[model samples]
Target: MPRRYLFYVEQNYCYGILRPIQNVLRSRGDEVAWLPVGDAFDRGGFEAGERVFDHVREAIAWSPCAVMVPGNFVPGFIPGIKVMVTHGLISEKRRKKDGVIYSFIERGLFDLYITHGPNTTTRWRQMADEAGYFEVAECGWPKLDPLFDGSLRRNASAGPVIYFASTFSPRLAAAPRLFDTVARLVAERDWQWRIQFHPKMPAAVTDRYRALSGDRLRVVDGHDTLQLLLDADVMLCDTSSIISEFALLQKPVVTYRNLSPRPYMIDVREPSAVGPALARALQRPPEVMRAVAEHARETHPWTDGRSSERVIEATDRLVESGLGHLRPKPRNRIRHWKMRRALRYYRLFPTR
Candidate 1:
């Protein structure tokens, strides 16, 4: 019998992380349904196996065997087992009061955690030991499989493609501070520029970059950035995990005032230094490539592209062994209220 699975998509852009797993499950005769948690489906225009439901009530009624999410919160009231697959590589960006990479695990909301590498798996195992609620699986990230499998590769003749990406946070974002400098560099060098923003980035910030788009520069709003990563020759970013992702490609990366500095990347304190740093990176590929290799090994250990298969196998073993049937942790009223408010603001659930 095929196990029925529910995949929650809180952001349309999360498809990049969840799609590979979904495809693997389906190929093995499991049924997967995509549940759009907010206005993400409408904005992202995602198509899936069944009718998309905007309300949690409808999803809970379906009684799936397991529910998988890439985001932080999942409704505990639902009978299905809640599985958390990370939305991105664990960057050094802090999102919690304790300076943790994310707030997802602190609440004990998930039954299973699918981690990207040993670094993340070790942290998650420590958390699981403390919480005594979730199980941890160290499957490599599913999204990067294409890059390793040769299905995706950079166009060598793409005319010096420069990818500029930013996080949504005001404190760490380079888009607001470096757009003009980037625009000038693109025009001056006649380089092909690709600018991509985080889905949560403020409309005003995206608008500013969109205005810089021209014959040489393209402003991309797609949910999946893997293609963009494969297309670019060099990457310009702030504190985004895209820096880690691009570094895995063994390419030069320039960071403008990065909140967290790594030995592998060229960090510039001022926007004026971006062009010079990019020039140095391009001119000195051997030095940068060595650093890129070290960064890639430390961040992601698996480059064989079998992460999605490992994830599916882990999920299947848990389900078949009935370990996924463990009761969800007791609900926290305060957290539920906050989540409801956020959903209502996004028009995903009713106000009442």
Candidate 2:
């Protein structure tokens, strides 16, 4: 019995995070389609055979077995189970001011929360025990499956490639403050430099960085950060979950003004410290490799690249047990109104 799964991608950059699992589901002879929310259809480069829905209402009419999303917002009134796959691994940062790290679990929006590791799973279990709203699965991140499977490797002859990635949050992003410093370092250093910004990053900010691109300095605006991650020997980031993902490669990461209370990577508060950090990361990698490896383990333990398989099995079990149909359908008029307003604002829904 073939089942249909819907992947709701609200951002273009999320394609990398969901693509691997989508492929896995399809390979197992399941029907998979994509629901590009808002401008995702314009920005997300979805391929052929990947059925794309023009409207959320239309997708809701189809009522697939389950719908998966990387973001927080999902319509609770939908017929199928709503799964939260997570867009990134940065769970340390609190979305609220009250210091609640796992608030997403309390929202009662998702039927299943696919966590990346034991650490995250433990937290979700505690939350589930309290709310009893969703089920938790400790599946490793599917995006990193290729890296762990040895299918993706960097060419040593390319010299040291330093990848600079940042979050879109104004308070957390290092791009606004470190652009000039990075440009100078790229111009002076012998290594190749690649800068990739969050898809939601302002156009003005990206344009400023684009002006600094040259023969050795590459500015990437596309959704393909996986290639940059695979090619880079060292990564420079700030408060972004990409730091944790990059650390899984066992390479050195230099973070600037990380918001996480406990530091995971080489912390550099000032722009001047970035050059020294990069030098140390490249020249003496073993000194920092230990901490990176430890952090990687804590972040995600499954390095065998079977995370997608685990996710597929979990989905099948939920569907087979008919647990997917038990998800709560709360009637919150205010919430529905807010969602409709947001959809209209993003031009995702037709106006009355």
lDDT of 2 by residue, 265-333 (tens): 788899999999898888646657877777777779998988888887787677677653354434555
Model 1 Cα shift for residue 145 (angstroms)? 2.3
Q: Over all chains combined, what TM-score does candidate 2 have?
A: 0.89
In the range 137-246, model 1's lDDT, one tens digit per residue, is 98888888888888776666447788889888888889988878977887799688889887788898788778877878889977778888898888999888778888
lDDT of each: 0.78, 0.77
lDDT of 1 at 95: 60
Badly placed stretches (over 4 Å) of model 2 are 40-44, 102-105, 155-157, 261-263, 285-287, 324-332, 340-352
Question: Which pairs clash in model 1?
Answer: none
What C-alpha lDDT, on a 0 to 100 scale, does residue 72 get in candidate 1?
82
Worst 10 residues of 2 by lDDT: 343-352
